[model samples]
Target: MIRFDNVSVTYGDAAAPAISGVDLTVPEGELVLLVGPSGVGKSTLLGAVSGLVPHFTGGTLRGRVTVGGRDTRTHKPRELADLVGTVGQDPLAHFVTDTVEDELAYGMESLGLAPEVMRRRVEDTLDLLGLAELRDRPIATLSGGQQQRVAIGSVLTPHPRVLVLDEPTSALDPAAAEEVLAVLQRLVHDLGTTVLMAEHRLERVVQYADQVVLLPGPGVAPVVGEPAEVMAASPVYPPVVGLGRLAGWDPLPLSVRDARRRAPGIRERLAGLSPTRTGPEEGDRGADRASVPDGSSGTDRSSATDRPSGRRTFMPLRGASGGRERGSAQAELPEHLAVTTRLGVRRGRAEALRGVGITVGAGETVALMGRNGAGKSTLLSAFVGMVEPASGSVLVGGLTPHRTSPRELVRQVGLVPQEPRDLLYADTVAAECAAADADAGAEPGSCRALVGELLPGVRDATHPRDLSEGQRLALALAVVLTGRPPLLLLDEPTRGLDYAAKARLVVVLQGLARKGHGIVLATHDVELAAELAHRVVILADGEIVADGPTADVVVSSPAFAPQVAKILAPQPWLTVSEVREALR
Candidate 1:
């Protein structure tokens, strides 16, 4: 379906080519995974096929890229629409209409298909992607996951044989993401559509992938093969893979189930094997303990608490619960931080949760998971009465956020919005954080001391928006921490971070969790959900579908299941150390 012949692309710079003399071919109906560290040109490579590299991004290109035998250089994005449909990591980045139906029909209309044809295609696409119910819903109001599905449906409507998605599910919670992925799988299996997807959270998608393409960061050749080979070489593999590798298996296993089939001897070999690095002690604050070179944290968990809860569990996590947690949310509440809630929410077009309660127990971290349209942000905003649930109860310590004379929720509940940049106004990271603290009424000494602990070495002179994407994210995180809000509402915390950055971000959140604060964060990172979430919940079409321990919710939905390594080798493990112990 797509071919790159000795392709090398260069942009204005004093450096090497982004992609150098690469030759690759994707068959007519196949799925390909594109993965590498941030900025290794994974996006650039995908763009080349769609003619976005030289057309939209503007870079000199050498060699050839062809789709359906037509040269990419010969066609612009508009010209290539029939053969290719592309979805990026950010859902909002591609919206061109006000409602889901209009967005789905936009591409077909541009293609000049007859009105009847356009309508038919739009209806079919909507049904196929599970957007029929949301057809008339405002695009602006759709949840992140729903919006992404609409984007994909818009392209698939054109009946393109090949679909390319760049981190399409990066912004969805586990349940919602599962719905989108199921549609993708059905298209591929039932309709024979070809797929090329790029993503950073390998643990969630690796199991379903037909093939794995591993790129070892910048200036490295792409490694394409079975999922096991590629994932085994992944410096930052999933916990289960890290464990399997430590067990010294001949070829690393891909899914946890695969590991199981090959586990007998390896398990015996790993038993009681002292890991090279003990990594974080139980009491150590979460930090970037890069267990492996790729942030896979290859610590061998030769001695972790054995699973007392027999790995089987059925949790009822319903209603609004979605966050970008790629880790666990353990309750370690401190007496100082408390948030209380009683059935809080926005029902229909009005507020509900009248007796709606709110609470953040001492040292407990909870995530408010839900679909995009489900009232996650609204509920968080309610901490300060941003959208007062029509009727409900709420309190921050002794004061009700709404009834309180002033909006103390600003200080009591720190917020890191989905678009972190929106919270930024200062010229530098320091300035932005200082402003957040000031708004929170925090003492200067308290703000500085607390912010410094989480974001070390960042300065006030560095523009908060000017920093690298990762740095900007850290800056935003710092800004919220400075307020010392006992209750935190973080929305999509790890949207664009790379593996290393994600690992570090998780460590910071974990550290805070240990410090005793009640947090309710929403995210689309399932691995983050499994690792860091104390509990997991699923939301679909504005209602909670599942809830309970992270492992339970994720495992129940095959679409959100952890990487193959987890299935192959069953162990309550996150890093290499945990895996080592499971094997032992």
Candidate 2:
């Protein structure tokens, strides 16, 4: 469907190409999964297909890009609209209509599709997307996932032969992400539509991808192959995959179910290597992270040797006397905030929250999850006193947010929005955090100490707004965390961060949870939730559809379940360490 021959794009004022010398071809109906670290120019490849590269986004193009035998330069996006449909990370930016039905018909109408044809196409798209019931609903009323589905549905009405999506599920909850993936799978099987997509959360989606395209960092050639080879040998992979490689399996399994079915012998081998749990890796995740020194980090890193010629024990944590519980949070502290009751909220004409409720006991960590538009943010905003619900109330440390002034509440419940750039306006990272300290009545020295520790190497002179997306996110979070708010609300906290940075955030949030600060992490990365959250909550149509222990909620839901590995081990496993623990 699309082809790249010796393609290289060097953007404005840059010394080298963002992506250099890449040659690739896409057949008529192949779904290719593009995987890589951030800033690797994955978007550059998509831009080439859409005529954004060397056109809308200025740069020098060195080779030809062909879509359906038509040069992208000649057949711009408008010209190729009937052949390709593209969706991006921020779905809201691409919306062209007020409601779901209108948006779906917008693309068709632009093609001069006849009224009868347009109507049928729109209705068919609504049904295909499982969005018929929401056909007339305002676009703003949908969840992040629903909006994303609408975004794809809108473009697909033209029946484009190819679809390109960039991190489309970054902001959706587990269930919604699954729905989107399932919908894509059905489309590929039924309509024969080809797909090219980029995603970071591999543990959830890698099992089903047809092919994986790895764009190694900036200025490197992309590597493409089948799932196991690309991921098992992946320099950039989730920790669980690392555990799988250490297990000495002939072929590394992509999902936990695959890991468990082959684990009986793997378990015995793991026990021989190390009978007890070990601490985290010393350095950043590298080929070296797998290179454990003195079998120290390896007391349980892997089970590569087949019993060292003989040994066995599948679920090691079950029998270990000293290993810690996988999902265990630290003992409580009296200083942390305690939350109880609901935060009522309304967005325009929609009743986003109708007697919706939540509780965060001191030092507990709770993950807020639900399909898009299920009122996660609205509820978060209400909790922080940013939005006023029509009724009900929120108590932070036994005090109503409504009773506290906006400025006063700022020091009580700290909240971070989905987009980091929106809340940041400071010229320097130092200045941004200093202001937060001022608002919280915290000492200037203390604020600087907090920022430096959270994002080490960051100085007072660094411009907060000028940093990379991950840096900006970290900076914004530092400003919020500086408030010393007993209760913390983070909305998609790790959206653009890399693996090392994500690990740092987990450490920070977990540390806070250990210190007895009530924490609510509203996110779509189920793996993260499983690893970090003590409990999980699911919402749909603005109500708490399910709430309980993380394992219970994840195991019970068909769509929201955690990785297959967690479900397999007889002993509970949350993080990759636990998976290793269970194997040992």
Candidate 3:
């Protein structure tokens, strides 16, 4: 239903077009997944489908893009609202209403639909997206994942024939992502709707796509084919596909279940080896050492100990028992880097966090995982003093976060919020870095150097808003790290990162953990958790439900398990690199 004929989009005064000479057709009733690295114009391509590229984004379109045989050149986004619904990466920006129910119904009201029709569609969307409980919640009070679902539901309520989504599941937990994907599947199969989705988390959605559109960077024509055909040469891919490539499987598996069917021989090959752990050893921090089951690689596991019983374990670093200097490097920081005791936070009349207690130790990486509206974001905010606890206390570097001054808080704790845009304000990358250095009293080039390490080749002259989602995130991360906070909090750090970018991030975070920095990341990316997190904390309805070593927490929970863990199950392996290391 969507067609791009020799399409090319270029912003004002750029050396190369964002995308060029792309001729593609997405059939009606099919879900087409747009895959690419960070800045290959996936968003631009999606915008063309919804007529937002040249219309609202102020870009020049070389060729025509059509939806349902109507040229987008002639139809503005508002005019095509009934035919095509678009949801951008930032959900909060899409909302024009205050509450969940109102946001969902806003689109239909704009379309001037019958009140009864709008109400019925709103209820259906709420149930479909599992947003019924959150229907009355304010959009601002809800978690990032909840806001994403609401954004999608608001668009879906319009009952458009075509849906264009940008990172639809980036903020959602695995189960919630599956629910959203399933809803899309139903729309495609039952209602003959067309879905054009662009996502960085290929592991979650690759298996469900009817076709794949691969954007291989600038100046290269886009490649469209069946999922497997495209993934073979596609630069970015899920862990399962990488495993299939390593094992020399005939057709790369898109999902864990498919990979498992062909895993027996490979399991035999890796029987006697141990998988590699991506981070530092637990080192007497009461780290849980759970064993893999028998079916996993046929490996014996008598040496593994029983799982620990507390919600979490905190091991104090060498100097942490007696408060040390606050500006110490990662190595000199104390083990109890940050602590929360019976934390309770409320927004208006709604309680966002209740009796929440957690600890981050020096040289430790903790991942906070949960369903939408589970208070993960709220918990992160408490650490940075963005939200004050109504009861109990939060201490970062031996000082109360809420009571600390902004200047002092920067040195103790730093947070890269859910929306990277919130932290970025300067016009150019160089200016942002300069401002960050001044604020943190760091070396002149420190922020720029960090940005290079996180995202290489990013020009200093580029506007922060002009950068792609992943690049903007890297820049924001750099700005935050300029303060050199002992406690680092990242909410959905891997939102738009490609596999390669994510790999670099894993290395960076691992280095920080080894140097004694304490890290707490609120994320829905299970693969990321498997790579960098030493401990996994699962939140649910404002309370901690499951907290343990990464292996125990993610391996046991099907929804949270990584691709390799699922395929190599019965072994507890969490990543493709882990499996490869075991074989070697």
Evaluated with TM-score, which candidate comes out highest?
3
lDDT of 2: 0.67
Superposed model 3: Cα runs more than 4 Å off: 278-332
lDDT of 2 at 493: 85
Clashes found in each candidate (C-alpha, N, C closer than 3 A) = 90, 7, 3
lDDT of 3: 0.81
Q: Each prediction's TM-score against the native?
A: 0.75, 0.80, 0.91
Give per-residue lDDT, candidate 1, residue 283. 45
Pairs that collide, model 3: 296-570, 296-571, 317-335
Tens-digit lDDT string for candidate 2 (212-247)? 889887678889898889886666676557667766
Q: What is the lDDT of residue 264 in candidate 1?
A: 73
Q: Give the per-residue lDDT digits (tens) of candidate 1, residues 310-423.
A: 211111111211221213222222354544444446545644333333445544555556555565655555665444545446666555665643333343455666655555
lDDT of 1 at 446: 41
| C-alpha RMSD of each candidate structure in angstroms | 10.4, 12.5, 9.3
- The residue-level lDDT of candidate 1 at 164 comes to 88
Once superposed on the true structure, which residue ranges of model 1 sit more than 4 Å away at CA? 6-21, 189-192, 263-338, 347-358, 370-374, 397-399, 402-409, 424-475, 482-484, 535-577, 581-584
